[model samples]
Target chain A: MQKGGELVERTETRLNPGYGRWTPFWFLAPAVFALLVIGIYPTISALVTSFRRYNITRPRDGFPFIGFENYINVLSDQTFWQSLGLTARFYVTVLPFQLFFGICIALLLHRPGLGMLRALARISLVVPLATTYAVVGLIGRLIFNRDFGVANQFLNAIGIGGMDWLGSPTGAFIAIAVMDIWQWTPFCALIFLAGLSMVPVEIEEAARLETSSKTALLRYVQLPYLLPGLTAMLILRSADILKLFDMVFVMTRGGPGAATDLVSIYIQRVGFRVFDMGMASAQAILLLIMTIVLSRLYIRLIYKEIE
Target chain B: MSTTLRRVLHGAGLIAVLCFTLFPFYWMVSSSFKDQSDLLASPPVWFFTPTFANYADIFADEKVFGSIVNSLIVATLTTALSVLLGAPAAYALARFEFRGKSDLWFWFISNRMISPIVLALPVYLLAVQLKMLDTYLVLVLIYLTFNLPIVVWICTDQFRSIPIELEQAARLDGADQFTIFRKIYVPLGLPGIAVSAIFSFIFSWNELLYALVLTRRSVQTAPVMATSFMSGYELPWGKIMATGTVIVLPVTIFALLVSRHMVRGLTMGATK
Candidate 1:
């Protein structure tokens, strides 16, 4: 016991700043450990497996050290190339349309409305975003079915021939794309709404005082402000679409002869369906590399998202 | 006259898009009620007497309630665990600077982007070895691949916003770091937790691939079971739609419930 105090608390007995400063790490220990196990371990294991041939049925055979053979075979495969091409098609087809429509809806919804109504509108828009892809895909398949679908019914009512959506290649692809855009555009719109709220009304008023045309104001001020949000949605959604699987899996199973298959579904087919883990690993590595490359470019182009 | 015409065009376009966006969902509900013959009619049915048979068959005969239970269990447990592990990590990253925090953050996010199917084989094998397949726990753990990072990322914002004085105040009061977190941070950051937890729950609930690979007969989730309805032409369209309506409607209701927090969570660090 010191002269001035009967007993001083051990923690309150301040050490050098460095001593207690690291205490947060102690608090952070469990989370970081778990993240490593759940996140890093399996990922590293996947990467390792990508290099080697893995067979679950013949586990006693062990994962042989196949080296670049898996990579080489995958590189030469026609289906892998086609799937990659389709994945690109999906990205090209969906991204711009979604961004444009999302922005438009956000603008319309930004008007003065009661909180409850606005909230209701927000909920209605967000609901599709939360629904699982499998459920959406299943419904999409039903809706796109030529004989039983409401979509074909709508088309038929207009004196147009009912299209066999899932039975054909292009029709099936478009149907899936449309389904995706439907589910995701609301997500983009919500992001846009978040972006819009960040716009300073004063800037618009100042632009108005300057007699800035609405188009000019939007072109210059609003669009510029929305870039970060748009960039984020772009990266996030692009990555998501590149890996589009469950929807396609449920909707078409990559069929009408592998028309709607994307990279992820291709990985699943090879790994699980065909039981070609080596080839599957190779294909997975290819997609992962491409995604990483694109993500890098995306980050470099729009790397201002530092928090 | 020209501006009015332009406004009219815009209005028409907006309404058209809204209806188009909503049509799939609308048709789903409608077709669920459509009779089989009417459903399969080449032109399809715009009007027919509504039928509860699909819902009846799905709930009563097909036994979809089990899948719903799976989805609920998976989503809820994953949310709980993600919060348990992710919150402290987020807090540490937000508040402290011992070492490697930036690297840790980047690593957490990179894991989020690695497509989940890549891990499916290994995880499947692991599940079999552990004999944990088709169970809620595997779904919860598999879900952490994305959900944990999400919790970590979302709470990073909230924890950053909390003034250090709160933590310091607790520390000065002889509270340990754990005590500080429980008493001070968890209470204040409950809203952020709620937002991310709802999202975490939704993510696991909606996740299909791991659930599909991990479960076969016993622990089928709604998403996995829903796929059975669309397998082939032999599927009864009305029954499929009814099941689809039941499966999706809850998620839609949930989305409405947490639209605000989800709005924030989806944006992550974009605005802030």
Candidate 2:
């Protein structure tokens, strides 16, 4: 029986020898075709549309080829630069708050034997993470509504006067950032928690024998182990931040003098509100280039550290 | 620090984190049950008889009900289609040694890096030209860009993790390639497939930008309808809160069900 089984196995394996060369190709074809139509084709079309004056509102004009005009126009446009600047500021400001809180929460919940507290924290954290961005925006609007909003109401209860959150430029910008931080800090925390859990117990125990201070142990041992997770969090957050749109759209709508106009919102406005497809495509291409380049740089840095 | 002091500090930090993470959801649910007068009350009425009027108002509207259905259909169909197409490709990449395999792998992973804005205009124009705007099919097709990469990434990792001995044993039993994939790989890869499905569902459900621009009147999803409440006159704080509650409830419940898998799901393909 064993010999017969071995003979059958060998023959069966030989029946599909050499990785079944044609099978994988057939298996991969549907996905490749889907990506081509949905991803690659549209991207190339966007590139083509950027060089033409294709305004949806102007059906009579037709999509005449306008070489470099849209790109040059976007380069000189003040709103474009302002939006880019705001995107950078939003990313820089919110990231540190999220990371700090994330690390703190991760450390607190990373204890090995604390079953109940860790479970509670994990459940609570998923609330903000799972809440849709649009809902977050709506909640922000409610909390920041100047007249009866809870934020101002809380301040007034403490004898501080109510401040206009959405009506003012800086308040609106800060409110948007706060909303982002609230929604995403949990994500960072959870990722950090996962990273922290991977730190071997023996390594920590050895460090504890040598060091008396918790901070020293963390700084020397745990942080180095968490470097990869930190890099992953940074890359993921930075990419998403660059493309942020929903909160700004729902809460501020780039209002009170374009205070919270992130690049995504600006591009959407250029395309849909202004019906300037050419300019929007140009701006989008630039945004895409920036996103890809920055992500590549981050990946390179992380890869070096990994080695 | 003394152990007592350390314990106190840790408890305090945990409480603060919990409150920060959960307060918004509390406020949303509470406000959803508040009357319009109670909703806008200064000093924010903490004690009040909760009302279902807001929920009643939103459910009474046909547009809102239609949007809820639209969101369900789009998210469901997108999840199914992405897994169907993406899992096979992931299996191929995981098991086969082909020319340019590494390059293909890199391309599949890097596809996640592309911003939706770059695809928005071209897709919108294409939809317009093809007369496919305001249709469920278009949203499902476009959502593939986001969902497929994740499916491929996670499913590939999943297939790779399964031992090759199982497949060899199946082959020894005289099973062919298709039978091995169906009877062996699919059943074994269920956990990973479930994770990928949850991811695709959450993404398609939470997606706003594509839905916002792609559909207008006939096919608006819940998120798009939720945004509509913000734009019009007399910002109906009651109905808006109610809508927010309804939109968040399903996803929150789903997340809690799979809370244990949250970290593993998010970090699956990225960590290694």
Worst 10 residues of 2 chain B by lDDT: B263-272
Q: Tens digit of lDDT per residue, candidate 2, span A1-307?
A: 7787677557755675534668888889999899999998998899899999988889899999989999999999999999989888998999999999898898899854446766797789998988999899999998998887888888887998889999999999989999999999988888778777777889888988998987997898888877887877778777887778887789998888899988898899999999999989999999888877865665566545422
- Winner by TM-score: 2
How do the residues B1-272 of candidate 2 rate in per-residue lDDT, one tens digit apiece?
79877777777778888899998889989999999888768768888999998889999999999999999999999999999999999889888767888667666666677778889899999999999999999999999998898898888888999987687777657887778778877899988888888888887898899999999998999999999987666788888889888888998888887776776565444444
Q: RMSD in angstroms, all models?
A: 4.4, 2.8
- Give residue B87's lDDT in candidate 1 (0 to 100): 92
Badly placed stretches (over 4 Å) of model 2 are A1-18, A112-114, A298-307
TM-score of 1: 0.90
lDDT (Cα, tens digit) per residue for candidate 1, span A205-291: 787788647678778778877887877787878678766788889988988898888889888988898877767866766667766
Clashing pairs in 2: none
Task: Report how far residue A207 has shifted in candidate 1, in Å.
Answer: 1.7
Please provide, for model 1 over B52-127, each residue's C-alpha lDDT reduced to its tens digit, 9 standing for 90 to 100.
8878787776358788887888788888999998998888887766567666776676665668787776677677
Give me the runs in candidate 1 sitting further than 4 Å from their true place: A1-22, A55-62, A111-120, A294-307, B1-17
